[model samples]
Target: MPPLSTAATPPPALRQIGAWIAGLRRADIPEPVATVVSGCIADTLGVALAGARASAGRLVAADARDTYADGPATLLAGGRLCPEGAAFANVAAAHALDFDDNCYAGFVHGSAVVVPAALAAVEAAGGSGSDLLTAVTAGTEAQYVLADAVGNGVYHAGWWTTALFGAVGAAAAAAKAGGLTEAATADALAFALCGTGGLRACFGTDAKPLLAAQAAAGGVRATRLAARGLEVPHGVIEDPRGFARLMAAGAFDGQVPATLGRYWRLLDPGIDTKAYPVCLSAHAALDAVRDLMAEERLSEADIATVRCRVPPVVAANLTYDRPVTPAEARFSLPFAVACAMRYGTLGLEHLDEAVLADPSLGAAMGRVAMAADPGWNDDPERARRAPEGAEVTVVTLRGDSFTRFCAMPRGSAARPLAAAEHAAKFRACAVLAADRVPGPAEADRLYGRLRSLDRLPTLDGLLTP
Candidate 1:
């Protein structure tokens, strides 16, 4: 890898992305984009703090602590590790509850991986808050641009695009945070893509979030190696036998990189901030059910049947009709709709074993059903427009009907959560880690710091009390 922008090796597409990353500055980002990036970083940190006590989070944090030497990067759970190790553990915690921000760009949980990686790399480099924001933008843009170029064919092909593309995004963010030049940044991208791939089978299990950990850590390692002048294979993404061809089934477009800085994908397709902890595939349906019940003033006892009309992709991903575990419940549309009918909301508390074993919840799940709209097959564009959207119909035991269609869930870009709502969520999630943060007051303090992350001179004491 070159120390400066020589661009002697990578193909045009990869080099174009590298040049964008190298040239990105704090001022180059539009205020709106930077605002969204800041919100996502704060949200990811909040969720990570909450998820630290989850089974997956606990296991990964322990593995990282035991395996890697201590260093400067702070884990959102607690303690410090080397940048790579910290990223590995923190990203897992961010994703363990499936509460992290999602993007249709690559159908990825973008911040769950990118934020932790950027946070670790920037802190390790002693970079400022502005540097962290700039690094996140660079990373998110590169990943989303590539996702646009490749389309969602790989996702439809059952590859976990979060892992496949997130690794590349993590590399971009880490490289930017570490101040790598264009050539070295391109090499980082290449090395990341060379080893990028994951299975969708990990869904509804601990493996899902752990794969996020692998991507985050792998990306940081790739950047560190590139910064050390490692000679990397160039054009790994566009190579005939490489990422695009193999992972995306030859679904590659050459024009997406040209519009990099000229257009920002983050503000357009935007991020989907989840309101519910369940799979995003189930959120639209959950929103619809919540609305129908509240509007009609119907209890779970009054509901005879609840039917969810969803896109084929949603139907495909949410296969757990009768979930017996919390992990499984996150992907279960029945569990999600039932929770909506019973409580009008889904929270981290609903994922507890006692809640999962509740017979009332089980009966409610039995009343809910989901099916794919065959019309989506005929009108592919409609499905593409609202891939995770749903139309729901609720029938009362008294023979009355109430129906609602939600094109997007509440926390989505079209209907963003209020700033106060973000703070409320942060407080709620933070209180879950009682062993790490002392009490509600401390969580509020941390929340304030995260929301004003751009003001911090360094991240050294940001997470500490």
Candidate 2:
């Protein structure tokens, strides 16, 4: 980067995004958008509390402690490290269970990366709560905007968009938190995109969340590099060999969302806060199965076969007919349907290794036949109760078949979880890490701080006294 704005090095599209990140403010953000963002922050922290105990979280926290040594940022779940290291650990923990807030338009886990990255950046600079909140909104906007800027080919092609666009978002948030101008922010964005790209194959492994963690750390590091006046290509996003061309293979045509700031992407085609712990591809199927089982009062023994109709893309992800591990089961539609039929629901409780290892689960998995349903979107929220999204046809031992269509899974924009429900989830997550997390009293205080974030002075109260 030549320092200051490089003239015409990047196409107008990338520069346009840069200007917006430079100008984002708590005042400019609409009330509804800010409110939604607060919920996202609370939800992400809730998930991270639980994730901190997961293998990915524990392993990364150890690395941050051993390698990072001393720093100014807290990991939220526990421990402290350098800002980037904290972000790496925190983001990984947030995504440990794949339950973080999601953006359907971008098809990425937005909150997992944004919250961790922004929190680390803000706390490191001793920034105010408004600064932290603003950083998150800017970061989310950048992620989705870049996701939209790049054609959907990368996602439909099965490359993880969260890892790809999320890095750029992380960089934007860090740049803002670090008080960079437009030129430095652009350079940071350029640096961040260099680390973009991850695989869907890592979905069930510890590697999946680590990929997200890497992106988070990469964002913070990119901003630091920019602030130190390190040199990166200016406006490399739309260059011949830049991010858009290199990442999209020339499919990206420089088109931008018409309403970048006029309307928050968080609201329109909104974020799908997951109700189920499984992959979003299978949430609709799981919802359908649970509803049918509850209505007919069917027992596991009574369930003969479940024919699940999803889009072809959805079926490709839920390929594990009889998953042998908890990770595999998390992506298995057959497994989700089986669990729903067996327990009348699927949740964190049913996703444990002990539950997955049961021999009886294999039989339940066999009875679920997942096929592609045309004329329907993969996302349940778009189903709009039109009976076109995901349908479950269950056959019982009595040879009677009961069918039902799920419009959308709960916790979606169409039927968002209330603030109390969101708090309930936070409490549940805190309970999982009770040994490390604050007690009920302190946790509630922290939550209240987030809800009225604009009034808080600094992020010192995010997790600590």
Best candidate (score: lDDT): 1
RMSDs, each prediction? Answer: 3.7, 4.3
User: Largest TM-score belongs to which candidate?
Assistant: 1
> Where does candidate 1 stray beyond 4 Å?
1-11
What is each predicted model's overall lDDT from 0 to 1? 0.87, 0.79
Q: Per-residue alpha-carbon lDDT of model 2 for 374-409, expressed as tens digits? A: 656545545434322477899998999999877667
Q: How does model 2 fare in lDDT?
A: 0.79
Candidate 1: C-alpha lDDT: 0.87
Candidate 1's error at 181, in angstroms?
Answer: 1.1
Candidate 2 Cα misplacement greater than 4 A, ranges = 1-11, 253-258, 374-388, 438-442
lDDT of 1 at 303: 94
Error of 1 at 390 (Å): 0.9
Clashes of each: 0, 2
Error of 2 at 164 (Å): 0.4
